[model samples]
Target chain A: MSDSPVQRLFAEPGLEWRSVSPKLTIERRLPLLGLLLFGLALLAFGRFVAEQSEAAGADLTGALFSGLAAAALVGAVVGWFFVVPRVVSAWRYAEREQDLLVSRGRLVRRLTVIPYGRMQVIEVSANPVSARLGIATVTLVTASASTDARIPGVPVDVAQELRDRLAAKGEALTAGL
Target chain B: MSATDAAPAAATQASASASTLRRLHPLTPFFRSWQLVGALAASGFGVFRDDLDKLKWIWRALHGDVEVSLLMRAVGVLLLVALALVFVSWLSWRVTGFAIITDASPSGTLLYHRGLIVRQRSQVRLNRVQSVDVNQPFLPRLCGLAAVRLDMAAGEGASVNLAYLRRQDAWALRAEILRHTAVARSRPTAATDSTEGAGGELIAEISTARMVQANLLDGVVAWVVLVVWVVALVVGGVVFGWRGLVTVAPGIVPVTVGIAVQLRRQVASMMRDANFRLRRTPTGIQTSSGLTSTINRTIDLDRIQGVRLEEPYLWRRLGWARVGVDIAGASDQSHHGASLMPVADRRDAVALIAEVTGARLDEAAVVPAGAQARWLDPWVARHLGVELLDRGAVTRWGRWRRTQFFVPYARVQSVSARQGPVQRRLGLATVYLDMPSGVQRWQAQHRDMAEAAALVGELAGQARLHRAPLRRLEPTLGTGDR
Candidate 1:
């Protein structure tokens, strides 16, 4: 039960990976749901424009556009609802003796290991939607800006606790930059 | 040299002097604002339409010269603007000053303040200095003046620029800071590294002729451009009829000229790298070179994140290569900053990379990209691969210009291994070693899936080994633990 599917899939024998709360599924995918609506609205707009134009085969044009758009919409629905949850489920972190490991994504997987001493700052915040869902996101900034390290949809208390612990560890293991 | 002291030992004893606020050269205003004044004069009255109108009204009231020529009025406005700029520059220079805040610590802090009204102040700890350099632009050099650029560790676009110091004073300041840093670090051997008027032991030197020759003969890209252009012409002629190809043939002139311009630029940079010399300092390497605007660059050995050697195909036969280094906080906007060796013997370039990163390429350990990687870039992927050493990782990639980058484990911010759907199908992945921004990043591209995974793990393990291992994070090893 402790082993995430991602940990088992990308197995490093001794490392024990910790997955985020299952609630992240809803929190991560809500914006995608909005994106899906936006796509539908764009399709409708295309059909409206097609109907208004005096071009030949306007209905045909509308049908062809709608068909491609509908197909894309269906594919997105499958990806957002089905493929995305699995990716979210795969999201995990492991705090080793010296460094922290964060791995996520399914089709194009990424695992980043950043040293505790390299952490410059740690931030924990929650938007209204996430706050209502009782969760917050923790972001870690290091001297190198591009090494993305974020743990999303952790319970608010858990996020705060993790941030404090990380800051303490970073201070205790302070290495000159 | 007349008023300012030039003795290295005296400078060291003074220790950048916490007691006195040293001002910039009196001619600093003239040198700094000349470019601004010239720009305003060139723009004439075109720059500020409203200001010009106001100036005209003031002139009509004061001079009562409605008969003044338009050109004369424009020239008058330009002269006024230039004068104002010069005045502002002088005032700003008067306010701009720096002093050592505390020499109590072996490694002290320098406080710099500038601006007449807005007034900005920043302090840089000597111990945190990544590197320092003396940059003398053409005008400043003519004036016997120089600017010192001090780079600090983990600086967020913040660097100390002390402009228009007398040349001796600049060198004295450099020596003082280096001595202070060495004293603070308890490295007595490094204390005598920066002596005024003396460069470190010369490691390598590139003659002006050799630099000009190598840069001008920089092939591969130039040749490729020619071949590709010819091929385009021929292919177009065959496909679209000779007449049509002729119609589009004029396009080739621009492309050809563009390539010529690129070659000219290479020659121009060669002039910049003229008399390129590399010396081994106690703390790092110092490069001093220039034809007109000379630059003296020092790169801290400990702050070196990545190093690369570039061997153009044409240079390969000539046994010439160039070495580049990425130092944290070292400015790379100018080609002069990152370049360690613009032109050197191939063996010397290799040795330079080894000296900096403590890693050398081993033919046995090199994992070359397989034919599968040919899909990446037919010209480049065949030569692409990575070599892992105890001290760092060496990534070799590039087509006609073979580049090898060494990223030491100590400076790696993070390790990442990623595989796309195609890479997954191909059983390959790319591993990236993250470094500070504005520097070249290293990647082990097109490695076997398992090898990539192992490489990531190995890198992470090596990175931890370089630093002190922390106490374990978990107490009870709850649900997250096995």
Candidate 2:
């Protein structure tokens, strides 16, 4: 597989680097699962409408039903195969001396950097499935709930260790500085 | 007089000793247990119904054939009641404990105890305390008991609850906290020798006139929205189920009346809670909500990310303005800077603007210069894109309100540029310059794209300058006082 080119690229200036477990496929692909579920729901709704139209003894031919079915199938297929991998590959974290950087998104690149010392909390949360898979999520809460940044799919052990380290480091920085 | 005073003092001591303040409510566990059991029973009904329905047992229970099972059901219910009572009573007995331990050492802390079966202790230190909130529910007011919550800056979900405190004790504790925090901030120490001296700034309290401004929506926009919502609901009901008029009449009228009553109560409560006061410590200025549970927030003057003043069509007619601040605090409920004022009086706005920016608005200053006029005048002209024909000029004073404000450019912490579809179509954008304090929210509306971009660039430069390296400031100056 020509050793994924992603592993060779290094971070540039103004970027901090953090690593998420490469093995965390299921956890990292959660958004894909959500898309899949939505597509399936839409498909079912379209089919139900089609059946209702037929039972009413009318030649209920509508573009909406067909269009929705096609859209659902396309969404399901694309999300499952194409979007998930691209999203995971682009996902990276960087813990700089100044800020914690999280960069992701395939087409529209989004890079969020929150200054480290200003971080209010480092909360480590793990679901049972994630724990079984040896991954945990770390949410770095700022004063604002809406803008809080979470880095999920981190290896469970590393996540906990990072949480403790960040909490201690952040508090010390505030107290000492 | 001495003998009579002694007798009265002894009687008073006896009565005070007999007071229940030292004791925890015995029904604490009962209330908890009742809530738990009620929730469980309601859920159980939903869970167990599937199997019972499959076997048609529910149908049998509803008919006369239930006679045979009636005795068993009655016995079962009685047993459940008895079990519930025993469990709740025992838990209440075990969990109920109340003790207020006040420690006046340098640590300055308060201790609270409650619970019978499962005892709980909440320890709150004075230094960690951010604010003390006392709430009086209808029942608590009648009982002369209030729920006091101490919010600490330790992070989220870090509050010590003194569930039931006498009204007097709650007030006393709040006052004590305020005094202690104030003393700690003002006190100086060698370690904190680097900070600058305190700058005196006046923050106007919410006067009755201000309160009226804050609730100006009572007669205008609020009523219109409410009426529209009610009308919509009634129309929907009539269209959907007009055949069920007789049965629906009983439900709709009461529901509508209940909604109206609830709205009235909400408005009244919000008005009562519309108190605003500026709280300042050595660290920074904080303008937070008072009186109401919905809008409580504390924003450090330095951390304000953006500010905007909104004057809707109706508000403009009413000579009012609403100010909103954007802070790091979770913006959903609290810490979202938004408030109403009946009259945007220049003096009041100027005073608020001064407190936030650490600069005074000098009266008789040249138009939009020296202090606020310098930045605000150009800010309004360049950013607001005021045409000569347009009355919304660079001047701080509005035609109706005649209020003026002078906010400095350097105090701005953040600037936001936003343009909606309509604004884009109109070739206009809105610019917001956020100040760290609760005042000096400068909004320039309907600016041309070029002007907005230029303002954004200028504000960005100012923000960068203001955001100096924390290390540059002497840490000792701000610390040892506490």
Candidate 3:
């Protein structure tokens, strides 16, 4: 059976796709895991201090403190082990002749399209943790306030290349306008 | 004043007059003081009323009698406030002034000087004038005065405003400025002659019944009232039993009724003139609207970025729609600047869109999205698609309320394509046409990824091909026919 016009229009015509660096996943997970461990240690230290105060005959409410700390520790552990990996895996970006596409989200997915001509600025930045992990984020700024398109967890070299290409394309395209 | 000598003499007179800075209407200070009086009345009544009540309670509690002197003091304070307000209004009126100076340049630069103490002076090149907004607030309207605000193509802070001018003077200034700045490049002399023939021709008039229906169906009152009523009933019933509903009923009724009345009045005021008129001249499309304070806005055809056709849910059922446009430098942040036709049938809307965009709706072929798009946008799949035209692209989408955007190749700021995780899995992508107006209508979603990529590439090429340098039309020699 022939496909309907709607099906034909939206049917996948597989094109060459470029994937981000696989090492980005490890880079994204390290900081999150570190933060989680740090938070757990802080909470444990607080609970210990509260218990020590209770032992010294002051009503320090050790039970309630410990319960809150345990709950937060559980939440941190879940976020570190579960949420971070999924979000990092979902991050993907593709460059076309005229525009750049960035998609990221686990459940409620969102895709942003940023054209080279519309990009007022293309910036690549890395924080201390990401730099240590050899990853950087690329941000595309436009005239509209709402559409802030950013692709995180790309290798530093890839981020720099994308920024330069986008900037060059933007300059070339904007000259006509 | 001979026909030959009259020209130079008039020019000299205009220059001489322009050199002298002038003050605003003497009554401007009084108009500005309206807020002061309102503030005084509210605070005075509130504070004095409470003070008097407290005093009476104290007297009754201690000596079982209240003195009348406290009431006299409150009255005296109220009178004093009124006197102070009048004095301030006078001072403000004395300081405010405006002047329009024709600079000694070929482009006819207009230097606008205004302000009381700080004295602000801004210059607007006559050719750069994009549109003029004539505003008359309640007091100014009653006093037969109006304010003229000139919107320029240069970014923000470029607009010049002259307030509290005689209504006739305001109209004259608008015409004179338009005439001075009118750039007739390719048009024949006959077109320029028609500009002075008469005012605009009435195109469409919104009926009172339609206005009321639009107001009610515009989703401001009906949905809000329904949601609030339901939430109130459910929550009140749960919290305080049947008596809770009864207690909330009286309060809700008065508030809802008050809001409904206010909303109706606001809609009515917005559609005061009710007539959507358009006039074509050598320079641009001229329009006048509003009942209380008539606004005259001029839309230069060259400055128009794109046009939008919208059908709200209720209006869609009735086959009614509205048309608006995105003009460069026009303050479209509010609905006032972009409004072309407030309400019309689909046919009329299409006609108006064609008139503005130079593209007929029927001429373009509509292509629906893929069947798999139903999974992504279940409500919009059938209605959403892109229409490729020779000169531009038109995209339509929405379930309850549909919107069609006409973006010409020359006006498209950028083109982009996106594919999310689900879209990647489904092989679908969304294409965006970033326009100058930042409106959401210019997007085509849920197309095949390859098709979207192809469309983006084609659109970019077309944009480059159609890109024309913006040129200001030179004033035609000897066409001073106006």
**Which prediction has the highest lDDT against the true structure?**
1
Query: What clash count goes with each model?
Result: 0, 30, 1
Q: What are the per-residue Cα lDDT tens digits for candidate 1 across B1-482?
A: 11221232234445544346679999999987888866765675565564778666756856855556765786698688778888999999878888864433335667687888998766665766767899899988998999998886545477788998999889888888787666556565454455643567888888777887787677447657767877988898889888996676688678879988876776668667987778888877888888889989887777677788888888989898888877665556422238888988888777778777677755437888755777756678878988888888889988878888887776677787776777766767788887766556678888876667667878877876675321111111111111
Model 3 regions lying over 4 Å from their true place:
A1-34, A49-177, B1-19, B52-83, B102-129, B152-160, B179-197, B200-202, B206-246, B250-273, B312-319, B327-337, B420-426, B469-482
Please write out the lDDT profile of model 1 over residues A1-177, one tens digit for every residue. Answer: 235433432545577777888888787778777767867976997779796997888878788778867876886788777987898797888887788888888888887888887787898989988898998888888767678888887889888888898999988776533
Q: Compared with the real two-chain complex, what DockQ does model 2 have? A: 0.05
Each model's lDDT comes to 0.74, 0.49, 0.66
By TM-score, how accurate is candidate 2? 0.49
TM-score for chain B of each model, two decimals: 0.79, 0.51, 0.77
Q: For residues B1-482, what per-residue lDDT tens digits would candidate 2 score against the true structure?
A: 12323433333333322233354344334444666677777876777776676336646766656675775785699579758776866655554443332333243445554555456555444554555555555445555665556665443466765655566665555555545544444443221211112122324456756565456553455566568867876787688766665566776678668667766865774554455555454444534343533232334354434433445445555555554444332223244344422235445554555455444434333222122222333433422222111111122434322333333443333344445555544445555554333344555555555555554545545443343432212332343242
Candidate 3: residue B244 lDDT (0-100): 70
> What DockQ, on C-alphas, does every prediction get?
0.39, 0.05, 0.14
Identify the runs in model 2 with alpha carbons over 4 angstroms from their true place: A1-77, A80-97, A119-177, B1-105, B134-147, B154-157, B161-168, B182-219, B225-266, B269-310, B323-347, B356-482
lDDT of 3 by residue, B1-482 (tens): 11433343345345644336566777776777777888776876687686797756655645636565755675688788777888876765655444444443343555555554676545565656777666777678998998888887654567787887887777666766665565323333223323322654445667757765665676555557757866876887888898877776887678768767766766664565454455665555666667666666777777777777888888877888877777765554433337777778899889877877687875767877766898987877999888988778888887776888787777666565555677766778777776554344367888875577567667767765665534452241232222
TM-score of chain A of each: 0.81, 0.68, 0.75
